[model samples]
Target: MNILFVADPLEQFKIYKDTTFSMMREAQRRGHEISACEPRDLGWQTGQPVTGQVRDIRLTGNADVWFTETPRRLAPLHGFDAVVMRKDPPFDAEYIYATHLLGQAEREGAAVVNRPASLREHPEKLAVMEFQQFTAPTLVTRDPAAVRAFHAEHRDIILKPLDGMGGMGIFRVREDGLNLGSITETLNKDGAETIMVQRFVPEIAAGDKRILIIAGEPVPFVLARIPQGSEVRGNLAAGGKGVAQPLSPRNREIAEAVGSALAPRGLLLIGLDVIGDYVTEINVTSPTCFQEITEQTGFDVPAMFVDALEAEVARGN
Candidate 1:
């Protein structure tokens, strides 16, 4: 099988931690072909088949410089047996445009992981509203007044932009609310943008657990990203320490509830962000933690992902 990964620059991958690279390695182990390109490389001029100017590469067992370039060319996404939309997201306008291109590829019968439409329909920060019972009290609003009110109500809350990733632009407003107005203004852009405000989950001290669901089935272990000193964000990018552990019953419950509903909608993979027992985020755009979980739990996460990818491709055929 041939797999084309729509992702960040191949040269920039931290192979030790990047989930996309891990997936590529696993696929290569199974004798599948792999190539990569950033979303910017995708193009769909009038006469093209929703094409991407990608670099074909094969993975090597190197701790550094893990991939060797084979060739570079413009090809229709449908030429590949599976198209993995593994681009990490701010979910900005460009990302949305890329999805439309990928959606076009899907229409042309290429199997795209995490269906393009589902990526558009379910923004990570906002998708939790679909499973309110499993999520913390969250408010999505642009109004500074509403934000202030929520801050007052919850006493301790987290405010972040709708388009943020890897804990960027996140703030915690405590009861005293030292910087509430300024933070609200910055995040909302004077009532011009929407943001999410959720009551701060105290259990974050333990860890913010990332539970991965593949093909509507939960991975048995989760990578619990524990925040470093004086940080509230448990994102590994934010310098959190990842600890892999078997998923608790509540974690399984959330994954099962959310996965069962999303799988039929073409979401081949999902990452559920659980704070305590509540789901705070549903990361569909390139959900990660493959290396961490595998290194600690002895679970072959990337191999499992490749297995699911192969199944989806065959099913589509």
Candidate 2:
């Protein structure tokens, strides 16, 4: 199988912790050919299928330089056995444009994981709104009055932009409401943009748990990213300490429900961000923690992912 990963630059990957690198390693170990390209490399023309300047790569065991690559050459996306969309988000216009190209590639008979249309449909932050039954009291609005009302009712709340990633632009307005108006203005851009406000779930003190669901089934272990020092965000990118642990019953229930609901829609891999018993986000775009969980729990997450990917491609064939 030739697997082409549509991801960020291969040069920027921190091989020790990068989930896409882990997947690449597993696929290579299974004797599958590995190729890669950045979203920017993808191109489409009227007469041509979606094509990308892709390079075949082999993993090197070196710590500093982890991979060796061939010179890039243009290839139609459908030529690969599987096209894995592992691009990280702000899910900005460019990313959406990449998905549009990938969607066209799928129409050309490419097996694209977590289908491009599904990625467009499920914005990680806004995706949670669909499953309010498993979330904290959440509100989405651009109006400062609505945010202030939510803050007043909840007393302690979290405000975040609709498109933020890696914990950027996240704020907690406490009971005192100091800077509540200011934070709202910053997040919502004074009625120009919408933002999400949710009642702060204090269970965050334990950790923000990342529950991975592959092929509509919950992995038994989860990576709990515990916030360090005075930070409210438990994202690993925000310097959270990741601790791999067995999934709690509540986590399992939420993962199963959400996983089953989303799997049929072409979401083969999903990461549910759960705080305490409630899911905080549905991370379908480039979900991580594969290396952390596997290293800590010996669960072989990358292998699981490859197995599912292979099965998916086989089914598509």
Residue 220 miss distance in model 1 (angstroms): 0.0
lDDT of 1: 0.91
Give candidate 2 misplaced runs (Cα > 4 Å): none
Per-residue CA lDDT of model 1 for 202-302, tens digit only, reads 99999999999999999999999999999999999999999999988888988999999998899989999998999999999999999999999899998
* CA RMSD, predictions in order: 0.9, 0.7
Model 2, residue pairs in steric clash:
none
Instruction: Give the CA lDDT, 0 to 100, for residue 166 in model 1.
Output: 90
Strongest candidate by TM-score: 2
